[model samples]
Target: MHKRVHYAFTVKRNQKNLHHQLATLPRAKASVKFSDRTDTHGRLETRVVQAPAVSDLGVDFPHATQVAKIIRHRTQRKNGKRSRETVYAITDLTSRQASPEHIAKIARSQWTIQNRLHFVRPTAFAEDASKVRTGHGPDNMAALRSFAVNQLRATGRTNIAAGLRAMSYEPFRRPLDLLCLT
Candidate 1:
């Protein structure tokens, strides 16, 4: 039997057509909504997520089951500074498979995924400074960087930068051993 995978993604301004489709949705009377608040490091943040089933909303994406708008309001407790932003997204999961609240959680968790994996590439590996700019060079370099990070993680290291530093101190052949090329 074949397995099916589901995913949710934010619609960026670059996706002009899809973004416009989701943008034109009625701002009033959403079919479902969820909100939550959290206090962290002198910041009080509240997030409201509104979603509607899109079977007839005419989203141009393939297999799009729902569309949502997430609004976040953040205020620094000490300074009383406030900021707000809104984001739009779509998901393949039907409303029956995932609630508006569940979709909100999935959307927020994407940041954690980015921070743990891709974010480290530039910070810890200096991927941004790489000179490989032609064709497959950049792609292959990215894959190698990801593999290095994953290898370090598989060795039970939580701090990737520190893991890299520790590995650098090892003999040159030690890192090669991790690649199983022997």
Candidate 2:
């Protein structure tokens, strides 16, 4: 017997979409529940997740075993701006295999990694605005940026922008020290 594959996807907000239908389901029908709130990066965020068995909707999503709805509320400390968003998702894992809490954790972890690496690379390194599209220029630049990020992280510099600034004045010294080179 082959083990079935599992998948998770957000449902779009459309009148005829499955996500809309599932989102309208009663809260009492949810099989799993998870909620968390945290203050980080000058912002406070609250997340609530509900997962329900998708056996009844199996015909619509053959391999889906659970559907999840996540509501996020965020407030910026600096500006006091607040925003709320809702997301719907389907996963192939059953409620027994993956609880709402586990799924929420996974989602948050993925976002953290993405924000750390991908978001940083683009914003801090100005990668998206780079005109280095010829030959290996882009790849080489990416590698160099990755190396810089790793070096900064290894040297106990949590803020890449500040690390880059510090290294800019003494590029040779910092890289040499980071590489253990005299």
Candidate 3:
């Protein structure tokens, strides 16, 4: 059942790889193209997307219908630093099921998950810096951190850092009260 589900995945850039070949193709050869620019989180970013038909590539990706390339140019507002990145992806959806604009939206929306969940787990909860390497210790710690984050979000605490600080005063007692666990 999982194999039949439609999905998209980013392709790695490797020499002689199908994804790399697609990425190197000229923009004029693309079947669909889209570009946009935005200022997000104090950084200016321009994303140019190119999508080509999967059938033309002679590659065998199960249920694959389209290949896409995203070129991103980013500039930091404070440090004046600049960077460029090109990403490639393949999706099971055909051109009809997923248009270039729609695919771009899907690709860009992935960052929201990264920012809200992945980033907060590491930075706000200090999960990455933790040295709990014993059997089940890391997993248990991660679960506890996730529970805390969920509790904070559930209680309408928008600022996780502040919520953590507030809970740390009484440690065990405070969290139990916050969650009504007592």
The per-prediction CA RMSD against the true structure, in angstroms, equals: 1.9, 5.4, 3.8
What tens digits encode model 2's per-residue C-alpha lDDT throughout 120-180?
Answer: 8998999999999999999999989888888888888889999888878898797787788
| RMSD value for candidate 2 | 5.4
TM-score of 3: 0.74
Alpha-carbon shift of residue 169 in model 2 (angstroms): 4.2
Q: Model 1: how far is 95 from its true place, Å? A: 0.9
Scored by Cα lDDT, where does model 3 land?
0.81
Candidate 2's displacement at residue 142, Å, is: 3.6
**C-alpha lDDT (0 to 100) for residue 88 of candidate 1:** 82
lDDT by candidate, in order shown: 0.86, 0.81, 0.81
State the TM-score for model 1.
Answer: 0.90
Task: Judging by TM-score against the true structure, name the best candidate.
Answer: 1
Clashing pairs in 3: none
Ranking by lDDT: 1, 2, 3
lDDT by residue for model 1 over 34-111, one digit each (tens)?
A: 999989879998989888888777778899988888888999999899999777879999888888799889988988
Candidate 3, which segments miss by more than 4 Å at Cα? 1-5, 11-29, 55-62, 77-81, 134-140
